[model samples]
Target: MASIKQREDGVWRARYRDEVGKEHARHFALRRDAQRWLDEVAAAVVTGQYVDPKAGRITWDEWTREWMERQSWAMGTHEAAAVAVQSVPWREGQISSVKSSHVQAWVAGESKRGLAASTIKTRLNYIQMSFRAAVADRVIATNPALGVKAPRSRRAEAAMRILTAEEVREALDAADEFRGFVEVCVFAGLRLGEAAGLQLRDVNFLGRSITVARQVQGSTIKAARIVAPKYESERTVYVPDELMTSLAAHVTRAQVTAPDEQLFVTPLGRLWNRNNAAGEWRRVRKDARLPDEVTLHTLRHTFASNLIAQGCDVVTVQRALGHSTPSITLNVYSHLWPSAEDKTRSATASFMGEIRDSADSVRTETEKPQVRGSRYR
Candidate 1:
């Protein structure tokens, strides 16, 4: 049975019971609309397909945070995910009221705010994932975010900046004062934090290698901390001869006060932070007259690029850089692989030469003078 009410303003409200015995209500300016809604609800209830309107009232923002809190993400990954989730426009709102248009608007607004294409796409992905979880929980009948296209992240191709050999040399020369950190990053491909957190025990001078086991982090000098290396994988990278010489010299000059002390420390004997290293790299790059875009990570890219250009295989480079997979190394440095056109041309030329030689042999046999004198006559 359905109940109807008419307010003094003449608007009508209708209430009905669904097949599942759940109550639903709707208001309309016209009695016909209210009656129509009741009919639709009754038919849906008969078909066992009625959905409560209250389910669609949750806001997108509320569900996203709930999803994030319940997820177990990596150390830095959780922070990144939180930022992306917060970047959504309706981040604080209920998930049920969010429509596809809101997502599109958020993406467009993020672009207008000068967010990088990659960042915008990442935020969109996080939102979509959140909505997916909502869909699974029956908070919404369907994910409104489905089929939404994210802007392609062009910054990846645009930001493929690599340092020139001259710039690398200039930066290395300028880093003579902080040779240990510079050599490890530029040659051994140690990330900034890994290099700063390295202890003397992590170095094997006899093996000509260093183990990346931990990372230095935190904001305050009093609260400086060491965290496990990214991905929890400790890798040993072989040192180049030149880098070995620089490391040995820097160690002797620094006269490290404690064997357990960090190999790269500030003048105050505290762990070196990324900001300080970046500032030093910038100063060196400027002193060497290199472009301002060159950064500490640029040294790592240079190392990988130089290695790939030297015919080092992708797997070897992957291990050298402490990458978890060779695919990562190949994806970044595959462009530097030798061109296949030259090999194809050489192969074609070799095949053509063989064909020509075979043709000459056939012609020589066909044109040979008759040797009938020794035949029985």
Candidate 2:
């Protein structure tokens, strides 16, 4: 309940207790203004929308630091999210002061600055997540980022460069000592970190399967740390005989017989990280004379392409490539799947061809009906 009265200063004062029994008051020059404020607070409380006026004064940086501390994200994920949080234009402003217009303006500015749409979208996602948490915590009345839209991603429309068998062979030959790493990526669809994190125990020779449970984090060996696979995509991936044989040969050649030893390491017996392997990757790419757009990741695309060509469904491809969802797999490789229209057209053409081929063997009922009435025809 709220009450209004004339204060000692001859001003109208409206006072009320919130749902939690916290007293609040506002003074206004006019009695109507005081009454209106009381009514608004009453309505907000009834609708379960009451927020402590002071709770939202925390700045974006302050709230984000608190929120991040509560998250159980991986080290790489935590670092990336921190970067996104730092990129917020309103990091120094109070969280409640942000409006939808401000978010839209920031997005527009990012686009004008020529940031990749994907990067902007990722950052926007992190912002939205934080804002949502704020709303749930009653630190803000609503999420300003709820309806904001990110710029369209151009990378989605770009053509993927899938390598051919001959190209794979040439790349393997050119990779020299790094052939095993490239082979795992191409055949098993492991990402760079996942491939580098492999240990002898991860391989099951009898089953010909490689278990992808963890990955090496950081860009260099000195800073590397083992972490769970991205999106918790830990599963066993079956490999072909050739890949299995290659792994065996690699193990024997490297003398890494210890089950806990890394499957792939530099010649110096240190772990292989992307930074240390980049120079050799460049040399191989050049020596193989591959397209400029073809990168180490292209081999992963090639693996998915082969699966789709072999009639693997979206779910199968998703699991094989360790994508978090089937939709993600389709988003990147939908164009590679044979369209229903193409299948229909091929079926109709094959049926027509069969009809034409058997046309001479067909006879109408009237052509053979002349002797049908005879008892012994």
Candidate 3:
């Protein structure tokens, strides 16, 4: 059946039933638009190029459940993707009938809603990727979320606070029972989950390198759930000899002889989380008189800064911090690197010094020019 009608809300509605007996309908502000939409649907029905328009009407909650079931990905990535999608405007809306204008409006709306541009960018990526999948599944003709304009959020170049060697010593002293865990975080640049997930077999005492392959899953009170590292975070980071000795002692004291045994844990022997970091963080923050803004992640920034300050290359620091690329490391810590002007100045000065040395050699040869002249003559 085909019909067009004007409703009390001053809108035109068009309805059609496909050959499969599936009904599709849409509303428009004008009878012309309704007629046009119906004509397009009629043409599609005739040539058999039409997909079920009603398929796009599935609620986001329903589609998400189905889409999630189809995805086999790392837990961390799945969580990230889920968070990114749920943050969007259409999270609870029908997935069909979404348009490029809707996505653009969402980007602008998110910016006005106090979301950072970087966060908006991430959310936009998730939607675009999802719509792309919808296209492949014949759920939509095009990805409505692609090529949208979003706000650009560039972080300030201000450097993070780095503990001096003396401060590090005091912080370690304040850690007391949790000192071993703090040591690895500050020295090895592991994320909190990675630190919590540290196992006996991952530490290579002979090589002084720690292999990071997995991270602790979140919010479990029972058996520790291990998952692949975040964002291609698997890497081998070498520790200094001083930290190596501490790790050796830590292993010995923890009685970790088994490969799967966790090297660091709460006093109760359970894995650590933000809520259960114990008084170790509190005591260290208090006794050390550290800045209130400094959290465990600050130790990571400190480690990266220390590495760059000591002339470690960005790639090495990127691997150590488990960043997906060196560009990320550079983006976050580029200000700490030697300025291009400084490098140019140093290079020019070295070249001038070499030129002066050559000039001196020529001066001596000029005095001996008569000798060479005689010999060649």
Tell me the tens digit of each residue's lDDT in model 1 across 46-110. Answer: 76455577775766566666788898775456666778878766755667777899888888888
Ranking by TM-score: 2, 1, 3
Q: For model 3, state the Cα shift of residue 206 in Å.
A: 3.2
* Model 3 regions more than 4 Å off: 1-35, 42-51, 88-91, 97-117, 141-144, 149-151, 159-167, 220-224, 274-283, 352-377
As for TM-score, the candidate ahead, 1 or 3, is 1
**In TM-score terms, which candidate is top?**
2
Clashes of 2: 0
What TM-score should be assigned to candidate 3? Answer: 0.74
Better of 1 and 3 by lDDT: 3
Clash-forming residue pairs, model 3: none
Itemize residue pairs with steric clashes in candidate 2.
none
Task: Give all candidates' CA lDDT scores.
Answer: 0.76, 0.88, 0.81
Best by lDDT: 2
Question: TM-scores of the models, in the given order?
Answer: 0.75, 0.85, 0.74
Q: Give the per-residue lDDT of model 2 (tens digit) for 87-118.
A: 87899999999999999999999899988788
Clashing pairs in 1: 58-94, 58-95, 58-96, 59-94, 59-95, 59-96, 60-94, 60-95, 61-91
- Number of clashes found in candidate 1: 9
Q: Provide the global lDDT of candidate 1 against the true structure.
A: 0.76
- The local lDDT score (0 to 100) that residue 377 gets in candidate 2 is 65
